[model samples]
Target: MTTDAYDHAAVCELLGAWAVHALPPSEQHAIPRHLADCADCAAEAERLRETVRLLDGPDAPTAAAEPGTAARNEPNPMVMSEPTPATRNAALARILAVRPPAPRTAPHAEPYAAAVAALRALLAELDPQPDGGPDLAAWRTPVIHDWTVQDTVAHLIAADEHLAAHLGLPANHPQDPQGAAAPGDTDWRTAWDTRTHRVIAHERTRPPTATVATWRAQASALLACPAANDPELAARAATLVGVRLPVAEHFLIRAFETWIHADDIGRALGRPVPPPPAAHLWRLVRLAVRILGLALGPTAEPVALTVTDAARSTEWILGAEGEPVRAELVLDPVDFCLLMGGRLAPEAVPRAALGDEAAVRTVLGRAARLAWL
Candidate 1:
């Protein structure tokens, strides 16, 4: 870490933004020069940049358009020329140089894999302290529900425990003294909450680095499992979080919560957490809608639900199977996720609605209740 004039800690914290081309000009100019002399930063930078590449997929166009160039006919300087196979391979080689190849995942698991990568990218921004401890200030920053950054990571460990155990991974923490309650048990939510608190309590007694390592090791094991790379294996259903869903849908659920909590941590640390890649975001959106429909059930009044982003709008009719749609409701996809994640109050979330107000309320309330995160 030999960038003489730049504060190394600040520089390291900005690496995630730099890799995503999100930094302002002054910050961007310092990174490359710093990376030339700093081996650790350089290696971490390559990993974060590679993570972004995977999220965007190999053939997706780079963000080359200039901020104000939408009105211009000239080629945008922001966009890079499309990569040839040779170039793509060279990039992959660079990724391999810095870390092991990312695990192969089928379409269903891809979002979860990319999400794990995204969280890694965010965590990489926390430069180590002078005494060789994890960055305690950043790790202690408060996130949602009285959780510090490290506690949130611990909670994720507990959240993923059921699925991991179902797939034959060993438990990451000791079982409750009374006994580990199955997901099918009558008091499952209590069991789940108790486990999360227990994990957080135990993790608080260890170094933050230890907590992070524990979380990462479990996440890696989950991704390396056969079901993560095979659709047929993920087709098998298991009950977790008090709901029975296929392993594939469970993977998406993992991706959803990971990104949401990452966003929570980012806000606490005063950094921005980019939403998942568009395709991944859509996967989460579709999943939330399906779950919402199920919660609404067959006999409730029908509402036409539309979720939108800049590129498109997707519509679904919720409630009674044969009834005419009694009301229409619209919400942005990100807002919908936040709503379902319990970060947004149903009444406070931005939306457009018409026809029966009560019907729309039922959908929004049910969606909010769906959140266990």
Candidate 2:
């Protein structure tokens, strides 16, 4: 095929094989350029690459043997012909089954990295048409907080800037004046709201694709920071988003916001975004519960709350422990998160509650008011 008229569709179809180094050399030359220009294709390529890496296992060879080398000449009886179609299909199925590829992060930054990957995957789903047609306009439709999908991403760019700057990473987009306020000169909320507005306003002046590129680049930079891979660097405490906490938790905050906005975009597009993979969900849930418990305080009546998932259930004794439990609440972990994020109203959220009505109401109301999202 001529380079000038390369068939992107055909190249995309070969991505899986290319990812596994199974593509013939003649057919593989065009993929790099195509991937560089195409966001959807790039995301799919990365996922396929990750799947291939996992299949190869950690100790796999780094390079192919030279054609005339002893290693290449000494083929054992174990060598086999190309896989049959069914065998190939089964291998592909197994690779695809490994959901949410593990993020390249230190233990503490894992949640944030995974959340970023999840959001990238969701955004990749937005472009359903290979030719890139009118359906692209859907990205501009209103999502949450009066922000469109494009605006929501721009908000994340602004949201993540705080931690990025604190780590001394270069800003991907122009910095909002408010975003650079000295610590304690401005409260996080005021600074946050101001920066978001300014960032959105600035982003509106550009195309949505540009805004997304900026956001993606910034997130990539954050994940690449030394702090993301070093517990020692990330252990330092700092004030971000109104909470004085270790840099590690701030990374989680980034994960939390990215997942929340991705959900917002998913909802506006009429797609139900699944919660993060179980382990990441639990991390998020545990963090949110800790914050909620703090918000509930020692004086509030104690309630026995259980958040359940398919594999396990976690129990939290919320509020004062001196009195007999005034209420019992059971919630699916995702529902509890939605409730705390203010995405679900107290009256509307699904839950099982028994005992003192006032205690249940207080817990639910406080949960809704947490509004971290």
Candidate 3:
């Protein structure tokens, strides 16, 4: 049998984690040998050890006292000591112990039907004041990377139409000769009568807040998506989290996108932003599960998890007892969408939220901002 090299990061993380907290003897013995020859792992172990000491020492009296129970909730360190035959077998069995691939998430209740109604109401109520009050006509037309409010609105309508078509519902507008829908035509077979008013107003007004109108349309279109009708209802719901989502994930993403972006639009319009309902929050958490799956795809081991959003920065973390996380930009739904949509830059992410910079860069490469048609 051939022996493969252990990951240096894993070795260091385990060493560091073990120093602060006891490891199973199996892990404790193996890591010392791995670290003895690995300068990188050794260095990391030193840092983690020092850091843990600080937390467990007088400098962190309060922290140290809190976990004074001395019983760490963590797994045995022996599992990580060395990838020995027995340990490897144990690890493999543990890995396979994970439940089968997650099925798509589906809506537990009638999903935001009221949100759709509200969108239609807002759409009808919307009337872009073409008067250009606070005007922006001199500016260039918004494109994929740099979207003006008008361009954003047009894209929103386009996105709605696309969703409508996918659902096998009547689209608000078919692809025209110039490949453009008339500003006011909104006769999609889906429940979109009121959307026309909003779209027409957006086309005419061309203001900064029109982006809000566009976002509103997007929410409505998602509710009306055809995939929501798929027999594999779970696969149908997952897409809301991303460009390609399964069903269960789809509704959760829908809830997140609608509630979050709607809040953004409210912030722009000076409207009181209602907080997302509790159900919406639950959906976002489910969406988080999908993110974990994506981030941990290449990883073979289980990873402990922590997710942070420097106010909507990235998405999740899923790995093992001590592997570099499967994901960096996964912990937060808001940041995940922004990063995926090219709305935020990598530099905008705070330091604490990222696990491995390379992993984030990889996610970025996979999902770039999309251009409007």
Worst-scoring 10-residue span by lDDT in model 2:
75-84
**CA lDDT of each prediction against the hidden true structure:** 0.76, 0.71, 0.40
| Model 1 per-residue lDDT tens digits across residues 231-264 | 8999999887877899999999999999899889
Supply candidate 1's per-residue lDDT for 332.
94
lDDT tens per residue, model 3, 16-81: 224433343344455656766778666655654444434344433222212223534543322222
Q: What is the lDDT of candidate 2?
A: 0.71
- Model 1 residue 184 CA deviation (Å) reads 2.0
Q: What TM-score number comes out for model 2?
A: 0.73
Model 1 clash pairs are 64-78, 64-79
**Candidate 3 Cα misplacement greater than 4 A, ranges:** 1-151, 176-244, 254-264, 272-275, 288-305, 308-337, 350-373
Model 1 weakest lDDT span, ten residues long: 92-101
Each model's total of backbone clashes: 2, 0, 36
What value does the lDDT take at residue 127 in candidate 3? 30
